[model samples]
Structure formats: structure tokens, C-alpha cells
Target: MQTSPENDLVTIEEAAAMLGTTTVNILMNLKRNLLQGQEIDGHWHVSKASLAAHGGDTKAAVSKPLCQRSTCGSCGQH
Candidate 1:
């Protein structure tokens, strides 16, 4: 829950708590590019704007992949 004095950016753990989600979920958003992130000193950095835009510290909504013919769990296309 450490804050960066340079930009006042909060850590992922803090963002998760503020957003009511797990850190892993936050990382997922970052990985999928659903949420904007910056790498500082080899670490991922999130901006307050990104968090606020996502509902004041909430998990960013990600598009779930549509079940394709090759991997439709329900239809067993595979």
C-alpha cells in the first residue's frame, strides 16, 4: 500500500483493495491491455485516471472471448 511520492500513484495491492478485487485480477487487466499501465524501473505502474475511469478503483471490464468452434465448451467444437 505504498504511494509513490513522485506521482502519487498507488501500488497494485492498494488499487485492488480500493477497487474491491484481487491483485491478480488487476494484473490480468494490464496483461490484456484493458487497462493502461506503465513500467517504471522494471515494475508496472498504474495511473489514477485509469482507476477513476474504471469506476473509482474497480476492475476494468474486459471482453470475454467468444467461444469459437475450436473451443466451445458447451458445443464441444473441438
Candidate 2:
């Protein structure tokens, strides 16, 4: 739950794409503490750092800041 501007958080779908996996697997990983993420407004936001550390494809993750996304109401902190 410790989110800061330095930590780029991606939505579950984005994380799945970065890791090349399904959202369900990502959710299980999050619950198992195999990944680092936080739940925000009923949605799961995965940590880009953790994803990269776990060998995920960083290039596949969103290049722009999450704040720029249309669904920024819940992720405008960045």
C-alpha cells in the first residue's frame, strides 16, 4: 500500500501484458506475496519495480505515467 511517484503502478491488465500472463495468475501471485502490488478502489495495481525484478518485460508496460490515463480518478497520485 506504499505508493509514491517513484513507483510506477500498472493496472492488472497492463501487468498481465508485461508479464505475459493472465490477470488471474497475477492476482494469485499478489495474494501469495510473489509479487508486489496494492489494491486501489477495488482494482489491483501492480508495481512495475516488482514486475521487472521478477523478470517481466518492462518494455511492455505502459511508457507514460498512469496519471495520463483516462481512468485517472483512482490513480492520479502520480
Candidate 3:
């Protein structure tokens, strides 16, 4: 789904993408009360304002590493 700045709500996935982080990071933030969101229909809906306050920019693209393998020990995926 497409979201505009005028939109107040965003999904957890969207929030993660905006922050250039993973969904698990967003969930951890939510659990720690670092980010604000509401659970609806088994999904977490985050506030765009909250994300912005946390330095999450919807227009900012995430930088990908040269290696995209989950087995990379540098990313703790191994």
C-alpha cells in the first residue's frame, strides 16, 4: 500500500522500511515503548508521526550490503 505524509497510520513493515531497518527491530522498539503503534486485526499499525520523530523517513532508501546472503556472519544471521 502507498502512504502519503498526510497519512497518520502505517503498517509495521512500512515503518521498518522507512527506518531502513527490519520488522523485528520495529517490533522491539514497540515492545520497549520507543515507538508507538496499535495492534489491529493481528497486525501492528504504526503512526507516521512517531516514525518521523524516531528519524524514519519514508523517502530514504535503505542501503544494501554488497553481500545479500543470510549466512553472512557479519550480520549475525549465521
Candidate 4:
């Protein structure tokens, strides 16, 4: 939530919101090493730099509304 030049720790929910994706997607990316994150207090904290590096602002990739369930199964809602 508090992002500074030294520590830009963002919650998984925050990263998902920024990336226009779901928390599961972010977690999957973390597991696959596509994104960099640190586990703190049993929760994942991602860096703003890492998000930027992984093309976090990929709103274009999210075609459906966040609340809508996808039939394609790409959003992991199926």
C-alpha cells in the first residue's frame, strides 16, 4: 500500500488490481517465476519494479470485466 523509492511493497490484491487480473493469476505468475515477490506474514508482497518489468499494466489483455466469470478458462474462473 505504501510505495516509496526504497520499499515499494505491494500486496497481491494491489498488484492484481494494477494488472487488471485476478489474485490467482498473480500468484500463478509468482509460482512460475514470471513475477518477483516476497512472502511476508503468509502473504505475498510484490515490488513495483517487478510488476512493471512483467508488463503489469496489461489492461488490454483483460477482455472481460473483473467481476464476470470467463468461459475461456484463461481467467481461472471456469
Number of the top candidate by lDDT?
Answer: 4
Query: Which is the winner by lDDT between candidate 1 and candidate 3?
Result: 3
Q: Which lDDT tens digits does candidate 3 get at residues 1-78?
A: 775333687888888777877887677667757678888778887877777774434323222231244653434654
Using TM-score as the measure, name the better of candidate 1 and candidate 3.
3
Q: What local distance difference test score does each model get?
A: 0.60, 0.67, 0.64, 0.69
User: Order the candidates by lDDT, highest first — what do you get?
Assistant: 4, 2, 3, 1
Alpha carbon lDDT at 10, candidate 1: 65
Total backbone clashes of model 2? 0
TM-score of each: 0.61, 0.61, 0.62, 0.64
Tell me the tens digit of each residue's lDDT in model 4 across 1-78. Answer: 655333877888988888887898778667756678888877788878777864534654333433264554555767
Q: 1-78, model 2: which lDDT tens digit per residue?
A: 444333689887877776776787678667767678988778898887878875435433322333355763424554
Per-residue lDDT over 1-78 for candidate 1, one digit per residue giving the tens place of the 0 to 100 score:
577554746677766777776777667667756566676676666666767776632433322322233553423454
The residue ranges of model 4 lying beyond 4 angstroms of the native Cα positions read 1-6, 55-78
Q: In model 1, where is the ten-residue run with the lowest total lDDT? A: 60-69
lDDT of 1: 0.60
